[model samples]
Target: MNKVIDINADMGEGFGRYTIADDERLLDIVTSANVACGFHAGDPRIMGLTVEKALKNHVGIGAHPGFPDLIGFGRRDMSLTPLEIKTDVLYQIGALSAFVKASGGHLQHVSPHGRLGNLAVKNREYAQAIVEAVLSFDSSLIIITEPGELAVEAEKRGLKTAVQLFADRAYNDDRTLVSRKEPGAVIHNQETVLQRCLKMVLEGTVETVSGSEIEVDGNTLCVHGDTAGSVDLAKEIKATLIEAGVEVRKLEEWL
Candidate 1:
């Protein structure tokens, strides 16, 4: 049987009249969308419009919640308590769920955005808090998190989880993503991205930027909607996966 992988993209990050991400075209190529909730990078209008677009495209809708930092784009880390994080996450998910419901769609999953996602992967306490919030809000919603760390914890707690690996981000020898501020953290070459993705799905192994190979479980693959040439890259990746006989689908559909 051909191996299958889920392709997901972050979208709907624009706030008010200001646009930030390159999602307008990226949405067409992805099977699942991580739509920005109001706290991170969206307003009510933008959220509604994004859900509508995803719904029309038959894509799975997911809430993308982040720290309340529109200025830093939610990339800057904040020293927030677990309760604080949980509260904000609930609010963001609630906001996105309302919009998705209004559009006659349902939120299929929840993926924390920016620093929140990175932090959750590295911190067990923080990751648990996030999982708790999602369960408290709605246990049926899928939890999308970094493959090894957060996914393991969520599974232990009986929450359905999808392991998300970034095709555009460099990983450490341990399979953790390199800090975004570091040089060579983000992959710019399309061929390299394609090759890495192929290895992940076919071999279940990825070579880290430091020339170390680590086993990785790629339940869902993330392509940054804001990255330059992201739309083109997504299109190419999809075609390549199909050519390799790798199934490209949403997380729910794949399982």
Candidate 2:
């Protein structure tokens, strides 16, 4: 049997009159797109346009919900109760769902963005809140996360879950991502990123920043759209996976 993996990216992360990465080009290289839902870096127009583009490319559309911190780009931790987190997640999902629906496409998954994403890994309360929000909106929506509290709780609650491995980000011994504030947290060299991705996908493990290897089940490989040369990196990664006898497809296709 051929190995299968999903290539995903965080996209549609720009507000009105302001843009981020080249989402239009990135969509062509990725199989799944995690679209921002206005809380972090998207607006209604961007959401609609993103959904439409994903549909046209037959890419999976996922809701990327984050904290209500536009200034911080949802990367800064915010103090919020579980209820607040749950409601905020639901609101973002709903906002993106409408645009997806309008484009005749159904939302495929949910991934908490930035700080919300980092917190969901170890923070039990935040993890549960995010899982609940996803289940409440759509029982079948897949939760894209790592093998952490969020993935555990989502699976326990009978929600579909997909393990996402970051190709350009450094990881800690605990399987959590290294902070962006740390040097070498985000790998920039395309060759290095490709090698890391290939190792994670083919070996079922990743090397941590501490120079130790840990098991990693990467159902999906994520490449941040905001990263420089992301499109080219994604293209290379996908091609390399294919050349290695791996199947590259959308997450929903197998999950």
Q: Where is model 2 more than 4 Å wrong at Cα?
A: none
Q: Tell me the lDDT of candidate 2.
A: 0.92
In candidate 1, which residue pairs clash?
none
Q: List, residue by residue over 1-255, the lDDT tens digit for candidate 1.
A: 878888999889888988866676777888999999977688989989989999998899999999999889899989999899889999899989998888888889999999999889888877888888898898888999886556777898888988887888999987788998899999999999999999888898999988989999868889987778888999999898889998888877765
Off by over 4 Å in 1: none
Among these predictions, the greatest TM-score belongs to: 2
Clashing pairs in 2: none
Error in Å for residue 68 of model 1? 1.3
lDDT of 2 by residue, 73-187 (tens): 9999799999999999999999999998877889999999999998898899999999989988999999999888999999999998999999899989988888899998998
Q: Residue 10 in candidate 1 has what lDDT?
A: 87
Best by lDDT: 2
Give per-model TM-scores.
Answer: 0.96, 0.98
